[model samples]
Target: MQPSGTPSRRVSAFDIALALGGLLFIFLSAQNAGPAIAALRADGVQGTFTAQRLDCVEHPGHEQCSWVGDFRSDDAAVVREGIGFYGSERSTFTPGATSPAFDTGRLGHVYGPGGSNEWVIIAALLLVGLALTLRPLLRLRRPPRTPAPPPVPEHLP
Candidate 1:
């Protein structure tokens, strides 16, 4: 018979390792989720800016006013004008004409960082963590699975 008051070594090293792994999964899931959300948010913001905003620029002595989305700013004057009004602008002017290198209107409304892909990855990781954490706990509480008792050995006559 076992002595009284001695602690039973019930938990195995494997179980503890699994718990640690599960925690790692939880941490990783959160980490991955963050960047994904940021990307999607950025995309959303860019989309909104693209759809809902406009820029305008005025050049000195220019015959016609060049507006945002106009041909593009090739000359320093047009570049300055764009910066004056829009706060910042990127332009690419080739021999023929100038054009915005980037669309600020589209850049302002991004909403997600990583989007659905990150969401799925994080969710799966979280689920894995939950499963890992629960499985051992459940097994620990469960009664020992044993075969039905065999008939008692025949007693001495």
Candidate 2:
């Protein structure tokens, strides 16, 4: 007779395959789709904005052009701007006193502080860590087994 309350052993290959496929999709999506999605969301933000595209007028640089964008509302105004990569050392732009202070900090770089390559490296590391942590969780399948085979008689009449 089977135990009164114990659950039966059930392992389905279909279920496992479905789960693995989902995990793979998630991993690939995080790697390839995350940045584009993030940019889309940022662009969706509602606020008064100004943007300008600039190129290195002075000297050659790693980056060709930079985009400066700012967001503003009744409550506050925030600047979302960065310098593009240039082959030269660095460039700075100073608007007049009437204008809000918006500095790119450095040239030949994305977002003024660090370059696009830096962000890419950081994002890649984060994804790697996420995958390592989630892989076991996604791959979890079975619990420990306790059942044993019954004894067989040596001689049969």
Candidate 3:
């Protein structure tokens, strides 16, 4: 007879793939935490927010996504610039608006206390995801066991 109550789920390929992807994100983010903290400590120039763009394109042959923003540097005369690669964010900065430059005072203000705490939060969430993903596989390893019936009493018969 089938077990009553909740049914066990079979681990599928998609679950493994998703777990791997989540793990990859956690790993990558963990690796960058140190550097990010360092960068947060470093001094940076002030800039005014000029514009922000999140451009994405998809085609049969290729796909591309670009995230960038223009900031007006304040150290000197008016100059438009942006940063990328290791420190990049999807933002919405309107032209003529003044806002803190990302790598500089903005990050510290937004993240609060050097910005390292967020990484720990991300790791914890990913760990929960990892456990959920492994649950199905772990369940599959232990098959349900049925109890053997007791021997009939000869006297009763």
Candidate 2 or 1, higher lDDT: 1
The numbered model that scores best in lDDT is: 3
Candidates in order, TM-scores: namely 0.44, 0.25, 0.36
lDDT of 3: 0.50
lDDT of 1 at 130: 79
Collision pairs in model 2: 61-86, 61-87, 62-86, 62-87, 63-85, 63-86, 85-108, 86-108
Model 2: per-residue Cα lDDT over 120-141, one tens digit each: 5445655665665555555554
Per-residue lDDT tens digits for candidate 1, residues 6-91, read 33336688888888899899888876666555543433222111211234345786433222323122232221222211222333
- Each model's lDDT comes to 0.45, 0.40, 0.50
Q: What is the TM-score (0 to 1) of candidate 1?
A: 0.44
TM-score of candidate 3 on Cα atoms, chains taken together: 0.36
Model 2 lDDT on a 0 to 1 scale:
0.40
Per-candidate alpha-carbon RMSD to the true structure:
15.3, 12.7, 9.9
Q: Return the number of clashes found in candidate 2.
A: 8
lDDT of 3 at 14: 75
Better of 1 and 3 by TM-score: 1
